[model samples]
Target: MGKRDVDDDDDDDGGKRRKASGGFSDHAPPDDGQSAEIQLDQMLAGGAGLAGLGMGMPGMGMPGMGMPGMGMPTPGLSVPGASAAPELDPLKPATTPMDFSKLGANMPSQEFPVPRDMVEYLMTPEHRQILLEETGCDVDWAPDESKVQLKGSAEQIRKAQRLLQRVLMHCNWGRSEAKVRRLLKPKIIESAVLRLSPMNTLPAGQKTLSQTQPVISIGKDKKANDIVIPAAIVSRQHCVLELDIDRGAIYVIDCSTNGTFLNGLRLPPKTTGKVLVSHGDELLLQDPANDQEFGYVVNIQELNVREQTKLQAPRRLLSTEESATMGRDFQ
Candidate 1:
C-alpha cells in the first residue's frame, strides 16, 4: 500500500521509466521464483511490525476489508503466500474420488439452530440506537435489519454503512442490560472496534473525485462536450457511476426513465448495467418520459496522469517500453 520513492531512469530509446527501490530490486528479473520468497519475507516482516504497532496484518481480521465470517478472509493474512508451505498440484488424477458428504453426515447436530435469535437481538431497537449514537446517524430508531437492502453503487453502499453504524451504536446503548452486556463482551467488542476503525482508503497521494472535476473529451477533441442531467430525474432515480481503477474505464448507470447514451449510441436502461466511457467521450442521458437530456464529458489529461501513476513498476522493469506500450494499446 506504500509507494516506493524511486528516480525515473531514462532509457537509451529516449523513454522515461521508474526503477523499483525500497529494497525491492532483489526480486528483479532472473529470480522469478525467488521473488515470491522475497515477497513472502517482506510480508511477514511487515505483518509482524504492524502487529507490534497494534495494527493487525492486512488480512488479520482488520477493518476496511470486511468483518470476519462476513465472507472475505482477513486482508493480507489469508493470502497463499502466508502459509509456510506452498500448495502442490497432483501429478496425476486421483485413484479414487474423495467423498466429503459422508465426512459431515456424522457430525453432531446442534440442539438449536445457529443463534438466529441472537443475531436478531443484536439488531434490536435499543442496540441500533446505541450504534447510531456512536456512528452519527440522526434517527428515532435503529435501522430495520430485515428491511435493510443494499442498492446502487459502491459509494451508496458506503453511505449505507455509515448510516447502519450509527443505528447499530444506538441499538447497543438502549438494549436490555443482559443483551447489551452479552453483545459487548470483551472479545466481541474488540473485534467490532477493530473492524470499524478508519483506514487510508485511497492510495497515498492520489486525488479523490471530489478534489477535481475530471474533464473528459472524445478522441482528438480539444473542446469537450458538457454532461447534463435534469434535476428532476436525478432527484427521483438512482444514478450510479463506476470507475475501473485498473482499466481507467468509467461506467454510468441509468436507473431512471431516461436512457443513457454515449455519442449517439443508446445505452441500456436498467438498475444495474455497464457502459464504457473513455476520456473526452460525450455522455448523454435521455428520458422519454420526462423529455430530458443530460450530457457529460471526460478529461483526458487527468486520465493520462492516473494511467501513468498506475503503471506497475515490476512489470515495467521486466519488460521493454515497446512491450508495455503494446500491452496497453491492446487493452
Candidate 2:
C-alpha cells in the first residue's frame, strides 16, 4: 500500500475505537521509548504555561518568593502599605524615660532661703511682679516667712533664684526702705571718718579722742563745733556729720540758713531730714550771702584696710558678786 493509504487506515481504526469508548483512552500500549518521549513533552508544556502566569515551583525564583516586579501575595502574610507591627525584644527591658510634663505632673519644688528682714521686701508687689514677668514663675512663702518656694521649669526657677540673690546683695547694704527700694550697691566701708573743712581750703586729718561720738559738728563757733568755718555765711549748727556704725552708712543733717548741697542737689533747711554721704560724694556748704552758684566742697574717702573693725564693742551688765568685788577693791 501507499503511505497515504496506510495513514488513512490507522486514523479510521482509532476513530472507531474512540466512538465505541466515548472518550479519549489508549487503544493499545505504545513502545516504552515513545511513551517516555510523550510524557517529557507534556511536562515541558505545563511548565511553560505556569511561567507565563508569573508562578513557578518552590526555590525557583517564583513570583510569590519576592522575585523582582512580580508582586504576588504569599500565604499567612500581610500586604505592604499598612501600619508596622511592633516587635518586642525578650532579652532587654524597656528603659525609655517617661514624659510627665505633658501629663500635668508636678515637679519637685525649689526653695530659696531668704533673710528674715528681707522676706517682706522680696514679697513686695513690685518685686513679685518683676519675678513673674521675667521668669514666668511665682513664689510661695514658708510658714516662718524665711524662705520662698518657686515652681516652674528648671530655667525659670534658676532665673528666679538669681533675682533673689541680687535683691539680697543690694538690700544687705542699708536696711532703709528708700535705699532698699532703689536697689543701691553696698558700700564696703572699713573706717568711716567725718570732719569739718574750711569753705576755701579743706583741712587735713585731725586727732580726736576715741570717747567722743563719731560725729563732728561744723559751725561758726570754734569751741562749740568739732571744726569751725569762721565765714559769716555759716550757721552755729550748720550741719552735723554722722557715722552710722551699725548700718555702715554716713549721713549729713542740714541745719543751716541756706542749706546743704549734696552733689549740687540742695537739702533745704527744715525740708529734708538727711542725705546719705557715700564714698566719692560731695558735701557742699551753701552760702546764702554770696551770689555764687557753687559752695564749699568736701570730698569723702572710705579708708581701705585689711579688716574692718567692729561697729560697737560688746557689752555686759555687771553681776552682783562682780560689783561687790569691784567696790571692795576700790575701797
Candidate 3:
C-alpha cells in the first residue's frame, strides 16, 4: 500500500486518530504508547487528563510536573497550608497567690541574729594587730573605735581595705565582717563562707615529737591507739581529710588502699567518702587492726597554724562606713 494509505489503515485498526490542529480528538484515544505521550503533553499544558494517570492536576511552568498538593501525600512531613500545633507553656505556675495569715502565724520567721559572743570570739587581739599593720595604723591602735577612719582618700580607703582583706584571708578570717570591711568596703556571702576550718594536732607519741606529724584524732577516747581510715587506700595515698571543725562533719578519702572501714563496715577504700566523725564516733582500721574513737573535745581555742592566721585577719563589711562618716563629719 502507499505510505499515507498504510498510515490511515493502521490508525483505523489501532482505534487512534490524529488531532485536528492544536485540539485533542473528540473520540476516546486508544490505550497506546503514542496516546499516552499525547495525554502527558496535554496535562503539562494545563489540560484535565492527569487524573487518568493517577496524578492530580499538573502545576504550571515545567512540563509534566506535579507539586506537593497535586494528589500524592508527602513521605514524612505535614501537608502545606496546615495549621501549626500549639505548644504548652512550661513556666506557668500551678497556683495563684492566696491569703495564708493563719499558716504564716504557725511558721517561724527565718531571720537569725549574728551572735555577739561568736563575733567577739572571731575578732581577737592577734586579728586586730594584723588589721592595724595592713591599714598602716599605729601599732597601739584599738579596733573598738566608733569609726576607724583611714588616712588617705576614698580610693586609698578602698585600696587599704582590699589589702586588709588579703591580710585577713592570710590570717584565715575572710568570713568575719569586721575583717572583710577593713579589707574590702562591701562584704559578700562568698567571703562569709570562705573561712577555713582550724587545724588541730593530736598528742605526740613518746618516740619523738619531730618524727611524728601532728595528727588530729576523732572519737571520744584521746588515748585510743587504733585508728580507722574510712576509704580504701592504695600503696602510696595522697588524700585529704576536710572537716568542719565546728560542726564535726568529716570527709575522708582513700588515695589507694584495698579499702577503708567505719565500725567494721567495708567502705570502698580508694574513693572519697563523707562520714560524721562526731563525739564518740568509733574509727577502726581494718588491715592493721587499729581503732580510735572520735570527738574527744570541740576545742575552739585549739587553733592550728592555718586557723590562727585566719583568726588574725581583719573582718569584712558589707558596706563602707566612710560615706556615712563623711556625711556626719561635714554636717
Candidate 4:
C-alpha cells in the first residue's frame, strides 16, 4: 500500500511540471524591451537641460557660481531679456595707477623752460599726464608755449625735472619715444665751475675771486670780500653767487641796499628772491642808468664741458690809465 501511494504522488507532480513548461513554450514572457540605443537616447535627452545648466560634465561647478575665469555667467539666474556680455574693446589702453612710493616728498615747486625742440614732445597730453600722475607734480604749459611750470614739493619737483632732462636729452639723441620712457632715474651733476668777468673798468687794487671757487661774493665793502669793486652805487652787502654742484646750476641772490641786477634787470632782494644765471649772462651791480659802473658776465660750465678741460683760468686785463684811475675811489 505505501509503494502504491508514493508512485501516485510522483506521477501527479510530474504532470503539473509538464503543464507549466508547455504553457510558457506557447508564448514568450515580456522582456526588458528597451534597446541600448533607445536607453542612451533617453539618458541624453535628460542631460540636455543639465548641459545648459553646466551640470552634466565634470568640473562644471554649480550653475551661476560665477567663479573667476570659470567661463560661467555672472552670479545670478539668467533673465529672459538680459543683455549679452560686453565685448572687450581692443583699442583701449588698460589703466594701471602709478606707484608713488618711489617719488619722495617735500619737492620744491619750480618752473622749467622746455627746449624749443622738445616743446611739442613734452607738451603732449599723454606725457603731461604721466608727469602729474607718476611724480605727483602739477604741470602746466606756459601761455607763451616756451616753458612748463611744475608745482610740487622739492623732491617731486626734482624728480620731474630729472625726467624732463632725460627726455630732452633722449629726444636730441633721436631716441624712440619708448626708449625715452625707459631711461628715467635720478641724476647728479658731477662737477661745475662759475666764471665771472668785470663788465667795466675796476679800481686799481680791486680783485675778483678765482673762477674755480665754488662760491663768490660781490659787494662795495673793500675788506673781507671775494670780489671787491669800490663804488658808491653798490651796497656794502650787495649779492653773492653760489654753485649747485649736484644740479650743475648757478643761483644769484641779491642782498643790497641799492640792488643787484641780472642782465640789466633788477633782482629781488635777499635770499627770498633769486635767479638762475645761465651761460654768458650778466650780473649788473647797479641800476641800468649807471653807464660807467661795471658788472660781471656769469658763465656756468657743467661736467660735460669740464670733461673737455676747456675751462680758462681767472685773469684780469686792464689798461694803465684804467688801473691808475680805479684806486681813487678806495682812497
TM-score each candidate: 0.22, 0.35, 0.20, 0.39
Candidates in order have lDDT scores of 0.36, 0.52, 0.33, 0.55
Best model per lDDT: 4
Order the candidate numbers by TM-score, best to worst.
Answer: 4, 2, 1, 3
Summed backbone clashes in each candidate are 39, 0, 39, 11
Backbone clash total for model 4 is 11
Least accurate stretch of 10 residues (summed lDDT) in model 4? 306-315
Write the residue-wise lDDT of candidate 1 on 1-331 in tens digits: 5765677678898876755543234335344455544664665677643343233434343343243532234444543334444545688654677778755343322111112333555445664454344333322322333343333344434443544433243232133444333222211110000001112221111122312332221111223222222344342433334443443434444444545555555555442234543334544445423332344443322323231221122223224553322222111
Q: What are the per-residue Cα lDDT tens digits for candidate 4 across 120-156?
A: 5557676677777667788888746689889887777
| Model 3 per-residue lDDT tens digits across residues 1-331 | 4445222223646866454422233445656646645665665466444343333333322233323543443333243465656655789756668887754243222211222323443345564456454444322222354223344344434544455434333223114434333232211111111121212233221111111232232222324322222333322332223343422223333332444344344443332223322222223333325433211222222222221222222333324453222111000
lDDT, candidate 2, 217-318, per-residue tens? 777787877666777777887777665444355556777886766665666343323455543445667733343333444445555323322211122454
Worst 10 residues of 3 by lDDT: 187-196
**TM-score winner between candidates 1 and 4:** 4
Error of 1 at 36 (Å): 73
Candidates sorted by lDDT, best first: 4, 2, 1, 3
Shift of residue 155 alpha carbon in model 4, Å? 13
Pick the TM-score winner. 4
Model 4 per-residue lDDT at 315: 23
